[model samples]
Target: MKITTLTNPRQTILLTSRAGNKDNVMTLDWHTPLSFEPMMYAVSIAKARYSLELVRSSKVFVVNFMSCQFEKEVLYCGRHSGKYIDKFKETSLEREEAETINCPRIKQALGYLECQVQEELEVGDHILFVARVSKAELREKGKRLFHLFADKFTTTEE
Candidate 1:
């Protein structure tokens, strides 16, 4: 059952933080590691998503690991659009400047991976951003929050 397996996979709300005069954060569910050497990852974002444009123009983003504590913020980011509301200001999620990249990182997250978009492939309603991880930092060594079917939450062992 592809649907069942997909629903059960360890899914984290991948937050892609953009860089610019005004930053934008987008919540993504379709993301995966593409390669291990040099640490490459790919994230699929709908073409209509405002953050997708921001990330494409900047070619850099930060992947923040969402925790259970940020469940509300995560849902808000996914539901709302950056074109209208300022998700960051509305959610009041503190942001810190990333070390290796210009994008901002969610301070509330357990850890973050700063990346630079190396390539992009347009696929259906979404565009896949192939990125190279530039830097990573773990604020706390704890379990990671995840999503499952039926709108359930789970965590992974440390």
Candidate 2:
């Protein structure tokens, strides 16, 4: 295993966005908090991802924090393509309008951060979207899902 495997169990999120009337969601694990005062967050998406184009065109997205209960849905979203199939239609996941951004948030998510893209930088094979949190909320109490390497996942004990 790579040393970065030590970073295993990174928080798993469903990045939701909209292009015109079409809504899209994708499973993502490479994201982080950037600022505090303005409450910024960043997510790294590959250039070929359909959601990347949607995010670029819409300039906004919702980081829907999922829980362990939705691991199957998470894997489904990650393994499939929004260009070919409707993720929501294929999975049990439900969506709702974000508080600030004009995108959808996962209803089954433990929480969500509606963000507006502040900057986009080319980071090797991925585009890093730096965003300012326009709205944030915790829907309920649950242990967040974490991605560990490939098909493995874990969650907090409590």
Which candidate's TM-score is highest? 2
lDDT of 1 by residue, 1-158 (tens): 65546556566665656646777777776888888888998888888889887898889988888777776777778778988877779996887888887778888888888889999999988899999999877788766667675456677776
**Which portions of model 2 show Cα errors greater than 4 Å?**
1-4
Return the TM-score for candidate 1, rounded to 2 decimals: 0.87
Model 1 misplacement above 4 A? 1-8
TM-score of each: 0.87, 0.96
Model 2 lowest lDDT segment of ten: 1-10
RMSD of each candidate? 2.2, 1.2
- Prediction-by-prediction clash tally: 0, 0
Residue 148 in model 2: shift from native, Å? 0.9
